[model samples]
Target: MMRREFLRGTFGVAGASLLSEVATGLSGGGAVVAAPKSKITGGTIDLREFHRMRRFADLSMGRIAYVERGKGPVALFLHGFPLNGYQWRGALERLSPYRRCIAADFMGLGYSEVPENADISIPAQADMLAALLDHLKIDEVDLVANDSGGLTAQLFVARHGSRVRSLLLTNCDVDENSPPPAFLPVIQLGHQPGAADKFIAPQVADKNFARTDKGLGIAYTHPAQLTDEAIDCYFGPLVSSPARKEQFSRFLLALEPNLLVPIRSQLKEFRKPVHIVWATDDIFFGVEWAEWLDRTLPGSRGVRRVEGAKLFFPEEMPDVIAEEAKALWGVSRSPGGSL
Candidate 1:
């Protein structure tokens, strides 16, 4: 069944109203009233509670929106483009008990309030993350990322390797594979005025439309299950205002240049433990790239390929991420935790 239909059948009026309020509040930058304290059921996090979890850090770049849970050593989660910290909700739900999990929306995407002239390039994103860590007084973190976030994570580790205890990367740009050919059209369209709005606004309006191959559905394994609330949470902010659209466009345009090639030597020199969990079916970033990462990195723990999964599989299959992360940290489910 379509996720929207399921939501209607399951929640009826009040639940739908709550979801609407959460979406409206998050997208419109208004207040969400009477949000349920706990919105996690099974592994998914409710949009309302996800909004409530948001904490902003004011830096020179902008007000960075993030969410954190648990109490222990730090683990930072970086999401893919056109997505926010909300993508890691499932992983955070599962792994927060063992480590303090943080998911920060990048400068342009999600709820991060950046200036009109803010440099939302990948390098600037790396610098922003450093400033954010400093603001939080965190010396180091176990870094986890997917898609473009993987690219930023590599740059982050290259620039601040000492600050990262380990690394977990999913399907994303790597070395010469940076800004894969499939993404060229997006960069092209992003350079044009109002093009991003044409692409994203419709998806936000119709949950099912967002699941089409033309939309973000191509990135997910189960596109039909992509929820209405998730669609609004992910795309609403990008189209909320003219300034936001410009920043989102800048984010894509900035990625057109190859930023990863210059860091190849640095990546090779990064001696921290690195684990790669790649989705084989991802057209943009293939498993060959994962193999390339394994061969390139000196401290690589090797690559684990998930057959038939797409680019955003980490959101759908958080268990794989959790398992790889625990293995990388050498921790397991036990009463005594915090490694």
Candidate 2:
């Protein structure tokens, strides 16, 4: 079936937030591998020790690894590219005590197993997520997606919106603006033979790739704060082997043309609430895109910017993300977020 057909087939119109067309202008577009295993929150624990908490789920393609915590209605998190579910650690840690938080490693990215002949694209990721929710018998959830996962969130809602209780989107692809140009180099690396190796070597040899744009630099305004330990949590598993590199390359190459265009029309049919937490300084996706989202997604709560933060603002400002999530669920601070 075509993409729109799939979306319309899966979802029923739903009700839920806050944006009408913005009076402002806009632009738009929009990883993990890490080791030394620790929990995903705030980079405080040893990744090795933390990752011990991950569990796997059997899916059609393969097993998906995930970290589950807290209690209440489910709050599922979808991470961006080249990274695993660990990217959601900070927010998960904060949000879990109230609502259940489950962050999964996309098939093959972290502890998840890769299925043979996997499409490895945004739509596939959405299918995987839907399968996971169904496997677990979850009916609806508050969905929070970042980076490329944001695109997946849009597709999921378009096709299976009833599954989404609400949505929180961070800096990511919007409408026609996707795979932001700043990130084109990583995709280009996948096109050339041995080019991915050049990018991978520095990361493995000395973890020096963290200093490069494709590494930690492009995503953080304060890249210096991403200590070697923190960087290890983000890149180690991604470049764990040559096969993994090829897998990563295929994932990059899978960004099919017109992947997001269809969502433009479908989203108009969306009535659920949406909350946009963006990093204004992110060159890949600027405020214009956020405004476009505010205008396009009638459910939007309005866009909030994390001043001075870049792409990985979720990691850099986890508390803010958690708080925003709480507000989205109408949970207030004091003891913990409401369930």
Candidate 3:
């Protein structure tokens, strides 16, 4: 079935709204720049399409791999740690018709190739994003992020608030919530030698293991439904080589010392429209954090709680993200198209 038809069938008209035409001046910049529309509009995106469309931007840090689709204003998608741009594949597919969605792999993760000594800290990741945007000639974006990506998004707002038009954050770090106590065990393991080989390699080697509590399964609402292809795409690169494993370990260790604490003042000062979506069942980030964000951000639109959803719920339930993103972007359905 066509992507639009399939989404419409799955979520009624609300889903089809994702593909409808958007207003020309939604970004608050001048008119939205036009780009070629997608030719293929059917079927789900797979590993093959991911590889075929992947592009790279060489910066001072290293090679950053990313995928871009859609047209009009840009919406930058940030993925969680231990995962990459593939996490937002569903969001990219669904929202492409309305926005130029770009999902980039952070350094030391996914397809982004960085030096062995590269600093993969959260702040550094935010800097890389700024450089990436500059390279792409994108002046502003609607930020959509999850997990550590949310943390990075906050830092991005703190340092480069002018470049952001809006933000949509899912279950992630906030203020003292950075490196939540529940994540200490993983950080400890990451600090150990050969952590990736011991903890990460096994998950990639045994796809079923990834669906268990011992692996990625702990974060997803429906781990059993996670495909083998996704396992390879998400975990394969983490343990691809000794350097990659070390980089992955460094990424976890860098999360310490609570980077978001100092940014509270900046968050309070930010006046851009913000939305916080939290997963109730997520043990790492509770609903209180979302409430905290709503109170902290002056322009916060408020929080949307997802009952029983886990940390990675955004990956499984892209429709919810689409709905929230459309609402945040001031997109409304009309007989002519979207406004």
Candidate 4:
């Protein structure tokens, strides 16, 4: 059925008539019920088409789940911990007009499969990304990363500087000594046998700020804007499979005791044009860390904030991110660039 017809049948004046017609048609071995096309939000773009989308490539780890769309210079996105590439849906929509935005579910998150007994360290994740790029025949691309993915992106650029054209980092843990207090327990637990899994499992559903409940207001600037459906989308993957929670637990454990040692010595020399986009009210990785990052990375651009945005700025202010990315790409802002 056509999209308008489908919508009309599902939620329009002829709802009952359409349902009866569809049921009778199906019963009589006629046309099958056609699913409605997923609608795009903000009249921007349809995100359902991108979730767990696949690419034909043979990397060491096999098929990976990534969403690649638009057509221009390639812009690669890596999401933070406890979240998947789905977090980039809004940003992707805004930037798609000017770039071929590719967002991937890092191994063990979203639809990507984590290898059993594989190294879950930041360096290992960087290597995986490199291999995937080689397999896909992508020589270089602009890199945008958030949270732990920022750390991973930095490591990747440090290891493969030639492959990175530019960098955009947001609210990520950059300083080794400044790990969030909320994550401290997880770090400590990883040192103990079987402690990692136990700690992360319960906290997955707590809905409290990772650092402190007090920061929830800052993290979620507009808490009322959040809906049950949105929360479900964000948290569903954590509980989607029995192995997901365990795998995530292992990944977080692998990150403890500092995951940046492999690339620490090289970060000071990473002179790529880097932009530090941060939220002023971030609770997890505070704004102070952004200053440290700017000072440490030579010639790094200073910090910029999304007014009233939280740690999850990609979701909260995708347009702001898109505008920043567009400026980085040296393009004029498009109609959808403003949040």
Candidate 5:
């Protein structure tokens, strides 16, 4: 089903009214009323609670949102743009039992705030992440990144190789010169004044699939399973902040030019063990990018394709990511080799 239809069915009028109130409050005219907290289900994880529950560290650009759970080797998760650390909700739950899991919402996304006139480029983001790690007193971590976060991960490893134990990338575009076609318009809009508001406002309500919501729905895995409350939890933040929208636009535009130079200079120098996990049917970025990344990085193992998954493979196949991460870290049940 389409995302709009699902929202209509699940939220009805009352939920819509709540969303309206949230939007109005963000505009500074209405008194903000905290919504009643939803009950947390043990079986199904909620990233909103994870974000809301944590205390954030003030960074160079903004307040960095992060959560640390469990113990052992640390695992740091970085998410893509338009989305936040919430993208790792599934992987965080599955992997939390094995190791310390750290997930952060990048500036201008989720609960994190973007300082005025701050640089939201990939390198800056990598620096912010490093700063966050320093603040948390973490010296090393196994990095898992998706989409644009993948680029940030690469920058981190390139700059500070000793800190990374291993690398896990899922459905991210790593090539500097080649970016997805769907991203071009957004990038262009970001460079132009007021263009982001004109372009992104209308489409924020709908599923962002090129063909059908089916492609987008696969990322969630359970289409009918998503409640209106969940949808609101995801979409409300973006609609609430106009500044966030503007910063996000700048972020999109800055990604390509800012990252291209660093990635080109440092990609070959990266010697950490790298694993690329890609979805077979992703419309935004294809498997070709993964192949190129694997070939370029000297320590890359290879690319692993997840069947019936899409761009958001971590969300779609969390178990697979957890299993791969375990194997990559050499923490398997078997004595010393492959399981």
Candidate 6:
């Protein structure tokens, strides 16, 4: 069944209205509504009471929307492009109680404020991440990153190595694989006038249109698994302003592998703990790269590969992420608690 149909069948009018309000609120002006229970692709995760959504101003960079939970040591999660902290809901639900879990929407994406000058490069995001940590008064954190977030994490750790206690990198751009083959053309299109809007806007505006070749359909292991809530959760932030479109386009345009050169040098001698959870079938970043990473970083404990998962495994396979998080951080579940 289509996700929209399932949503209508499951909650009828009230659910649909709540989703609309949340989406509207994310854009700019509307009443904020939190779901009692957020349904994943087909199931539900009880997140109503635990979730904390707020916006924090980062000096001159504008406000960044973030999701937070738990109360122990901080474990900050950085999401990739075209998505937000919403992607880490499952992990946040699982680990927040044991550790402070925080996930932020990158400056121009997700629910964050879209500044007139949207800085969306890897370095820019890394800078914004530092600002966020400072704003929250979090001096150090165990960092977890996936997809493009991994790249940003690399830059963040490289530039501000002291702030990171441990690092977890999932399937993402590494070395010379900044813009994967499938996304190269899309990134190229962003450089042109009005081209980014033509390609990016339609997918967000229409639900069914998002599940085709033009959108994120190809990135998922199975395109049919996408939910309307997920799409709107991601799309609402971008559709809210024209500046956000430019930000997305600029992020693609700024893809450069050379930027990671410093990270290689920094991570080589670094003694901090590092773990990897990779998707074996990811077309963008192959397992071979994971093998390369394991050997390069002195802190790398090991590499764990997940078969049959794709680029978006953090969301698609959140249980896997939680398991890996537990293993990486040596976290033990509390009595009767489960991920």
lDDT of 2 by residue, 136-200 (tens): 89999999988887878888988889898899998888887776654565566667676446655
Order of candidates by TM-score, top first?
1, 3, 2, 6, 5, 4
Query: Once superposed on the true structure, which residue ranges of model 6 sit more than 4 Å away at CA?
Result: 1-52, 335-339
Residue-wise C-alpha lDDT for candidate 6, range 1-339, written one tens digit per residue: 222332232211222211221112112111212221222433234333313355466566877778787787899998876778877878887777668899988876777775667666779889888988898889998999988888888888888999998898888877767665545655655677654466656776776767643356645656566776677777766756667767766766777445776567887766789888776556567776777778888888777776555677777667677777887777666623443
Instruction: Give the winner by TM-score.
Output: 1
Using all chains and alpha carbons, the TM-scores for the candidates as numbered come to 0.87, 0.83, 0.86, 0.75, 0.77, 0.82
lDDT of each: 0.80, 0.70, 0.80, 0.63, 0.64, 0.69
For candidate 2, the per-residue lDDT at 203 reads 60
Can you write out model 3's per-residue Cα lDDT over 1-339, one digit (the tens) per residue? 233332232212332221222112212211111221221122366778988889999999999999998888999999997788888878888888788999999898899999999988888999999999999999999999999999899999998999999999999998898887767667766667987887678778888977865467767867787888888998889888889989988988888779888888988999999888777667678777887888889988877776656788878788778878988888764322575
Q: Best candidate, lDDT-wise?
A: 1
Query: For residues 236-303, could you state the per-residue lDDT of candidate 5 as single tens digits?
Result: 56556667667767777766564545556577877878888876555556666777787888878877
How do the residues 51-164 of candidate 1 rate in per-residue lDDT, one tens digit apiece?
989999999888999999887889999999889999998889878878999999999999999899999999899989999999999999999999999999998988888899
Give the CA lDDT, 0 to 100, for residue 120 in model 1. Answer: 92
True-vs-predicted CA distance for residue 52, candidate 3, Å:
1.1
Instruction: Give, for candidate 1, the lowest lDDT window spanning 10 residues.
Output: 21-30
* Candidate 4 overall lDDT versus native: 0.63
A best-first ranking of the candidates according to their lDDT comes to 1, 3, 2, 6, 5, 4
Q: List the residue pairs that clash in candidate 1.
A: none
RMSD of 1: 11.2
- Measured with C-alpha atoms, the lDDT of residue 61 in candidate 6 is 80
Clashing pairs in 6: 70-96
- Model 1 scores what on Cα lDDT? 0.80
